[model samples]
Target: MVQNSTDPVGWEHFDHDADVGVRGIGVTQAQAFEQAALALTSIVTQIESVEPRQRIDISAENGDPELLFVDWLDALIFEMATRRMLFSRYKVDIEGERLSARAWGEPVDVNRHQPAVEIKGATLTELKVEEQDEGQWLAQCVVDV
Candidate 1:
């Protein structure tokens, strides 16, 4: 069963016992990755609540798509932790094994943002990057929160 939906480019949360499963679906692989990042932010607070007051540029490279996906999300997690921010908007461009992304969000406001939990990192467990027969793409993994 699906939990959350955001249409066109959207994310969903799946059950994972102690952890949460974040999945992104889109018409393209890059879009899927972008959506997955949304799922990551959603873990803490409502994505709609985040104001795009800041923009951060992040890039990651890997030889495999699955590993690349993990690296991409990990980079975002690092930025969030270090910058003390929550990202809501993301634009990802993937070429071969290289990924260039720009995330937009503002500093975390405890009262306004009301973040629920801190996301520790993205794990490789249940990691997948696959294209559907209908031409859409899916990116998912169990995030360590």
Candidate 2:
């Protein structure tokens, strides 16, 4: 189970397993993806100041929704860490559990996009993806960040 303190989107882990495991949430899968990115951003920086001014189109497919979620977040994190960029907008087109999404942001600078934590990678513990009757998709992923 996951709990929230005050954040609109975030991730947490069970005790004793701590950083080795993590859990994330959002109102929708796309939102969850964004939140997961935010959590990653939180790990790498203050987040609130990280300006999202650039955009990129990314499309990936996988049979497993759980793995797909992890892979999606990993790709974004990899771009951020390796490319040093910050994005503020996301547009995801999901069909049959596959995602074709676009992310918008700009390069991170020491003055603007200072990362808060080093997210090593995404994990697979307790990962899940489910759609609610209300029409929202929820994806939970345990990232190594």
Candidate 3:
């Protein structure tokens, strides 16, 4: 799990055979989504090693929260592959079925980033977006690595 000592928001990875599961926890759905993106980035490189030198905007819409979460991750994966970048920071806004966000990172430096794996896409396996407690939200899914 990736977390700040004073922050309740965090991200984690779980075993999923050949692939991997990414999960995020936060006080709000938007925060959970942002943490999920961090989890995705962590799968490839240490989040602390990345510099937020560039910013990219992303948007996705789906009536179902679970499906929308998948779209968000897949969008990030697409951006990473096409731009040869790794994002370390993210800000997300959710209104109804729509999601709008911005991600910040720099072009991958193999010597510095040391990416462990390339994520092909986010999958529906174990997909979930739910409020687990009165003030806590969780977002998660299995990713094709």
Candidate 4:
């Protein structure tokens, strides 16, 4: 998908065997996490189709950014599975190793959402989080389906 200059935060899928790979890019680490969550949501359905009717709070902490990304995504997966919801909007804040975030989405509508697959959890395989020379942050990992 094409990312607009006005909104530097975006997510994409990379080829992976059996599972799917998700990558998020943004100007800040928080934005990258938010975008990565979006990527995870997109794996199941078109994110734009999900309504922001309900709000969910999520948080995670890890000494390393890569592990933090995995924790963040895993928390989201737990919420989505338990709530039977799909999140399209996210706002994240990171202070040191702790991350606080809010995700907004409604319960799944099978007819409208047309979800493709059930995402089990985020995995450490191919995981990475880093800042580029141009100052943008990237967070990525493969998720089990």
Whole-model lDDT values for every prediction: 0.90, 0.65, 0.94, 0.91
Those runs of model 1 whose alpha carbons end farther than 4 Å from true positions after fitting are: 1-8
Better-scoring candidate (TM-score), 1 or 4 = 4
- Index of the highest-TM-score prediction: 3
Per-residue lDDT tens digits of candidate 3, residues 1-145? 5556336689889889899999988899999999999999999999999999999999999999999999999999999999999999999999999999999999999999999999999999999999988678999999999
- Residue lDDT tens for model 1, 74-144: 99989999999999999999999899999999999999989999988889899999997465799999998
Distance (Å) between predicted and true CA of 113, model 4?
0.7
Error of 2 at 17 (Å): 4.8
Better of 2 and 4 by TM-score: 4
Question: Candidate 3 local accuracy as lDDT?
Answer: 0.94
lDDT of 1 at 91: 95
For model 4, how does the per-residue alpha-carbon lDDT over 32-87 read when each residue is reduced to its tens digit? 99988899999999988999999989989999999999999999999989999999
**Global local distance difference test of model 1:** 0.90
Worst 10 residues of 2 by lDDT: 13-22
Best by lDDT: 3
Off by over 4 Å in 4: 2-7
What range of 10 consecutive residues in model 1 has the weakest lDDT sum?
1-10
User: How does each model score on TM-score?
Assistant: 0.94, 0.73, 0.96, 0.95
Ranking by TM-score: 3, 4, 1, 2
